[model samples]
Target: MDHATPRVKATLSDEGQRLFDLFRRPQGRSRPRPGERAAMEGARWGRLTVGDTAVVTYRWGDGARPVLLVHGWESRASRYAKVVTRLLELGYSPLAFDAPGHGESAGDSTTLIEYRDAIVQLHEAHGPFEAVVAHSFGVTASFLALRDGVRARRVVAISSVPDFGYVVDAFCARTGLTPRLRDELRHRIERNLYPGEADLWTRFSVLTGAADPRPPLLLVHDEDDEVVGPEQARRIAAAYGERARTLTTRRFGHRRILGSPPLVAAVGDFVSTGAVSGGLPGAEAAR
Candidate 1:
């Protein structure tokens, strides 16, 4: 049952429904602060036009091996600062881009399709990435890109949502939208945001057959993650069978997992050597 069902049932109205839609749309985008901007000033920066949006990209190191860093929703490329540094130390170049509607990109709203387009555009421009390291919602977009033929030797998904339905469920729970209103919202999203695609959710899901021929995947999730539960990671690992490995952390939670030294090392090791060793004590290996 949705936690917000009671509140939504009590306050159901046309205006409330509209507000819920607006709330579901991506917002609260963060820009690089002075320190972050200064830190990234030395990196090569540019923009690529995808459809009607301009995505800002950053490049660090000049190594032949290129790694793509995909940040989550409401986040920018700079969020991968520590990971980029580690990758550079491992003799691999790191490239990252701000998705449209976030960071330096131009747009107020974006969808998974846009995210996939941006990834494809980046691949076309600087690709055949050695590996793609994606976090949170970016993992879904990265998986979709891989499914649609973007080439990457390996992938690291941290704090990932296993399916698109989880996002829908979370939105409904947060907004206290009743099942009826939730259905209406889904219909409106299909009609307005994704008119041409009838099965957007299924198409976007990482666990679905859409993401076939999975790359060597390193699935990392914090046991204490409040945003995306650890079960999502386990489910994804199970879905990928022998092609994936799972790592669980204790105190890292959701966002903090990104900055964990051991996590960073594990990702770097996986990308560079196709193996990860000496992780946190309780880290579980799946297949």
Candidate 2:
């Protein structure tokens, strides 16, 4: 039986349905500030039309080995300024895009499928990316894109959720939605957003989809992460077996973990060496 099938059996009131819809839609879309824009002034910028929205992309450096940077929910490509600068210094081309509904991209809200399609479009136009550095929700979309055949030699999943269900659960908890309403919300999401895919949560889950012989993965999580717990990283690492390596940090939290000097250096070292080294401060194995 489908995981959401039992939940959908419960009836929901109109008010509950509306509340669920509101919770599903992303809020607080991030727009680049003057300083952020100025920081990216030297990069070449372009846009790709994905369905009804335009995804804004920025390219830094002229290296043949392209690396993709994916920002998390409610964030923009410019958020990875430090990482992009580091990648450039390491002789790798770093390409980042503002997802639809975030930053300069079009749309008021976007879903995981939309994010996946945007990644695919970018890959088709500017790919085969040597690696992808994805943060939070972007990790889910990036993994889905990889499963759908977006080529990448390696992946760095930073502050990632192991399952899409975690997002729905977090939403319900934050909104105080009743169990029936939560079920109805899942029903509506399945019907409206992912109608063609009956098992979206399972299919989109990195923990479930990651298998043997897949691209090498570097799972990075902060011990003090408030948005997504560090255990999510452990789950993903365990799922990928020997192909996956994890780096655990302290006090960096979720958003700040992206730009942490230690985290950035770890990513650079992983990409450059193709093997994770031991004795790095604040780093630990997943197992």
**What's the number of clashes in each of the models?**
0, 0
Cα lDDT tens digits for candidate 1, 53-89: 8888888888478899998878888877778878888
Instruction: Residues 1-287, candidate 2: write the lDDT tens digits.
Output: 69776565543456666775686566778666564565588789898877788778888888478899998888889878778777878889988888878888888778788888888987887789889999999999899899888999889999997778998899889888878778878888788778899688888788765654688899989999999999888888778888888888888899888778767787787777766655567666443
TM-score of 1: 0.89
lDDT scores in order? 0.82, 0.82
Q: Looking at model 2, how many pairs of residues clash?
A: 0
- The 10-residue segment of model 2 with minimum total lDDT is 6-15
Error of 1 at 163 (Å): 2.0
Give the CA lDDT, 0 to 100, for residue 252 in model 2: 85
**Which runs in model 1 stand beyond 4 Å of their true positions?**
1-13, 33-39, 281-286
Give the lDDT of residue 47 in candidate 1: 86
Residue pairs with backbone overlap in model 2: none
